[model samples]
Target: MLFKNIVTIAASAAIASAEDVYLTVKSDDSSINGNVLGFPHEGAGLNYFFLGTGSATAFTYDESAKEISYPFAGSYTQFFTVFDNFVAFSVASANTEITFEDNVLALNGSTSNFYACKDTNDPYSYSTRSYELMWYASDAPSGCLPLTLVNSGSAAASSSALPSSTSASSAAPSASTYEGSAVKYAPAGAAALLAGAAAALI
Candidate 1:
């Protein structure tokens, strides 16, 4: 029974390390509609990929309130490997405003990498849009980590097989694949749990 309890405690530590930040989106332009993809590590020479699709539930643009809201799916990640790009979207228009809770971090008038542009070969889409790339910076929260490193041979092998697309329904990498390469961070309560487990054993 003690052995089972110890194993459970270890599993709990792993789960705690995974964190998530919620974002609420809004834009003055009502016509703007589409999906968001983001590469967390800006330094990595990587292409942006779709993160979340546009829909009434996932993305609701309210012209009256000038806001857009997204359903909380483990859609956004605390871990970078869940997807590439911090947050990129192929919305119908260029200007956007992103919020975390009540804090307005990026605004429609403001154009940072948040509005950075890259040429798109998507036969179905056009126009440059704003994206939020979170990294450790003066303005950004310090609780950030660099892009995950994988064996070059492994990343190239994987990338070559998986063609990038702006499909609205793009899914995150499977758990087996991501967890294999994902860098797990210690969650807030992880240390306390580990200490408690050790004490119980003693």
Candidate 2:
């Protein structure tokens, strides 16, 4: 019974500590400005792309750990991961911390590697092709869209001009596809509960 109580407290604390926020981007090109980050479909391992339209994906941002995750996915292992400059969802432990400051998203406190490259085909059929998320060290390939990751709320408040491109009507990925992922964090609440649990054990 004591063990079960401790586990319950720990889980509850984690849930309580998570903050809900949207991952949105902006750029000089109005065509993709104010776009949200999303995946094409529901799958365990899938790459995240940019959607020109539709509601943005709400992610759990653990301010303490500087990690972003989708806790609604039902599995805590799914995290926004980067490999060889490409971004995707994976169960592997995240190696870097992600944070948003001054209305820009930063990785390990730097905001240099994020880029959006156009895909070969339009999968969502919204007439606008989806942009694959990637990280570039120095120069991005020709035609790739440069972007700044920002908090959705901040983006909306600061955005004065609406996208004039026809692609603004592009559909975003369905919410069902956001399942099976989460960000990991060591919440202070959980730590306090653990200390109390230890005292009880003693």
Candidate 3:
């Protein structure tokens, strides 16, 4: 009976801790390299939202639940769409190889790594189409252009934009208007229960 009770208590604690993990992603790469959106063609300006240091974007996920919520601005040209800068991901567990379609992203050490992928069909189709993807570990060929990493805004702000862009060639999006800094795994009542149980043990 004692062993079963201990297991139950341990499981509860694990659940509580796992519910508190979240991620904050802001636009960091804004250079003239392959990493920047629309590279080798027209520069989206220095402070461009997608390529330049424009705004901060954030994503929150619950490891235990596998639930993710992200917000970003959509393209300026597409007035009807919103949240255009959203990216899709496939992650099973922590420390496991996580894969994101189109772009590459991983929590490398302390800094989160991200790679921008160009559209499948290029407008100009330059001789070396490898520069479409930007980042150090980009899957692009060896001769492809390299991306230059830079710092973005300190905090993300909410904009009334949407995620709709299929490729980097589209005009960069505006920041999302939903400003959520953190994520919660459990409800307010769950925290209360955990606190009460911890106090009883004390």
**Which number leads on lDDT?**
2
What ranking of all candidate models by lDDT puts the best one first?
A: 2, 3, 1
Residue 94 C-alpha lDDT in model 1: 22
lDDT of 2 by residue, 17-71 (tens): 7777766667778866766555542223333454444345666677776777653
Better of 1 and 2 by TM-score: 2
Estimate every model's Cα lDDT from 0 to 1.
Answer: 0.27, 0.54, 0.28
Rank list by TM-score: 2, 3, 1
Q: What stretches of model 3 exceed 4 Å from their correct place?
A: 20-24, 28-88, 91-112, 120-202
> What digit string (tens of lDDT, one per residue) describes model 1 on residues 1-202?
9999999997776556422332322233222122223221111221233222221112333333333332212232222221222343321232344332233333332222232222322221221233233322234333222221111212112232233332221122211112111111112222332243232122
lDDT per residue for candidate 3 within 124-191, as digits (tens), equals 33222232333333354333333323322233312224232221212122232211111111112223
Query: Candidate 3 has what TM-score?
Result: 0.30
Model 1: residues with Cα > 4 Å off, grouped in runs: 1-3, 16-24, 31-35, 38-47, 50-113, 116-202
